[model samples]
Target chain A: MHDKLREHIEKIVPLSDDEFSFVCTHFSIKKFKKHQFLIQEGEVAKHAYFVVSGLLKLVYTDDTAKEHIVSFAMEDWWESDYYAYFTQTKATMSLECVENTQVLCLSYEDYKKLCDSLQKMERFFLEKANFGFVGAQRRIISWLTSNAKERYDQLLKQYPALIQRVPKSLLAAYLGVSRETLSRLAP
Target chain B: MHDKLREHIEKIVPLSDDEFSFVCTHFSIKKFKKHQFLIQEGEVAKHAYFVVSGLLKLVYTDDTAKEHIVSFAMEDWWESDYYAYFTQTKATMSLECVENTQVLCLSYEDYKKLCDSLQKMERFFLEKANFGFVGAQRRIISWLTSNAKERYDQLLKQYPALIQRVPKSLLAAYLGVSRETLSRLAP
Candidate 1:
């Protein structure tokens, strides 16, 4: 489990044995069954979960009680109600397991401690955050310019595995299209 | 000019006088008039700009040659085709001045230098990137769930100054709405 995390970090900056052990101390491993909520709306998001296996969905529920998919995180991905986690506020979003899942969880204090103690860890996080921002920006652009079919095709092209793993109903929600519309696109 | 940059950085992490001077050395000041293109499409985006004053519009031109507004960056904001800037690729989008603009430009090499020399600088960037990601996530949720009127109102509530500074046409483009539709919402 820790090897997964070490590989993820070392992708950006290599860690020696001692350094990897120190990094491991800042995270704890947890497992959840499918449909379990890792973060519940209106509660503080105590941990940012890095998926070691299986999958999770980050979501927001609107006033009318319709759920909107913010993003999906599978193996090697990170998911959290980050606004809530960083600000220590009640979550406006929720994270739920899509499969029987295992993750390494890091609390805000531990994240800070790791960054303060090891500058390389900070660099790793900075790279991750930069790419995360870029991904979000691309999504925003797609929403601005693309039709439903184009968006679907773009998603399929970018994450073919994700499309295979996710249910059509959930994919419809993520695309902000109806099940009927998704059928037209995928059928 | 450097004071604005210092103040922005200090909002997340403070630096001493000498430390700030070292940070300042990595950035150079550049000014542009309204309607000037800071980043042109198909050109490498060499700088990530920090706005000291005035406003910028980052735009994407579609296949039909119609421009789509990606984002607006006003005073105290950062603007760039960050994907291109960081990756050293040709920009697919362009950045233009909306008002007479003064920006502190940091090249990719200088960005690395600052991060390498100052742990505090890396922390500052990490904080900014984290919040940038959060802001992007919120926009995605808005796109998924909100009507044009609702998105307009949300933008107005969140960045009243930006709304006031931006022309209605650009605002419409940013919202992925027609100018007539925007007029109906705002009026």
Candidate 2:
């Protein structure tokens, strides 16, 4: 499990074995059954999880109580209510396990402590966070400028595996479109 | 001038006078006349500029040669073709001085050296880059979901000074709307 986690971290910032082991010591292995809530809105987000196996969905609900899918994370991906995690505020989003899964969870406090202890780990987190920000910005731009079909095409091009794992309705919500519209556009 | 820059850097990371001075040594001041190009499309973007005085416009031109304003930087702001700078690719966007400006420019090589020298400076740059990404994502989402008037109001709320300094046409381009429409909506 440590080796697998290290592989993901190495993609962002190469870490020595000792540095990786030190950072790994802070993570708690969590297992969730399908349809379980890892996080819920209105509570402070304490931890961010990296998927070791299975899938998770990040969602927000509207005033009408309709849930909108914001993002999905599979193996090697990280998920959390970042606003709440970063600001120590109540969460506006929720996280649910879409499949029975295992994750490596790290509390913000532990993560900060790990960063202070390991320079490579700190750089790794910083680089990953920056890259994630850039990706989010690009996704937002694509959503604003592209039509439904174009957006669907872009999603497929970027995350082909997600199409197989995520439901069409959830994918529609992620794309900011209706289920019927997405169905028509899907190949 | 160095004091002002030091204060700006301190917003993200506390830096001692010695550290600030060391960071400052990596930068060179450059002056630009109004409408001067700091960077142009097809050229490799080599430097990121921190505005000390005046304003700069970041824009992209389409195949038809029509320009779209991406962003404008004023005093205490930083501007660059970040995509090009991070990836070391030819710039697709251009940076032009909207007014006579003085800026502290840091080449990518010098910036990397500074990051290696000071861990705090590295974290500062990473955090700022992440903040920019988050801001850009929110801006795109707002553009997609909000009406023109709401967007204009939000833009003013975020950058009150831009309304007075930037031309309406450029603002319209940034908002992805026409100049006439923006003029009609302006209070």
Best by the lDDT measure: 1
Per-residue error for A35 in candidate 1, Å, reads 0.5
User: Candidate 2 local accuracy as lDDT?
Assistant: 0.82
- The TM-score values for the models, in the order shown, are 0.99, 0.90
Error of 2 at A86 (Å): 1.8
Top candidate by TM-score: 1
Evaluate model 2: give its TM-score: 0.90
Error of 2 at A15 (Å): 2.8
Candidate 1 has a DockQ of 0.92
- For residue B132, give model 2's deviation from the true position in Å: 2.6
Give the DockQ (C-alpha) for candidate 2.
0.38
- TM-score of chain B for predicted candidate 2: 0.96
Candidate 1 local lDDT, B1-187, one digit each (tens): 7998999999999899999999999999999999999999999999999999999999999999988999999988898998998899999999999999999999999999999999999999999999999999999999999999999999999999899999999999999999999999999
Worst 10 residues of 2 chain A by lDDT: A137-146
Per-residue lDDT over B1-187 for candidate 2, one digit per residue giving the tens place of the 0 to 100 score: 6677898999989987788789989999899999999999899999999999999988877666778777789999888887787677899889999899999998989987887778888778866765675576566446534678889999999899878999888888877778899998894
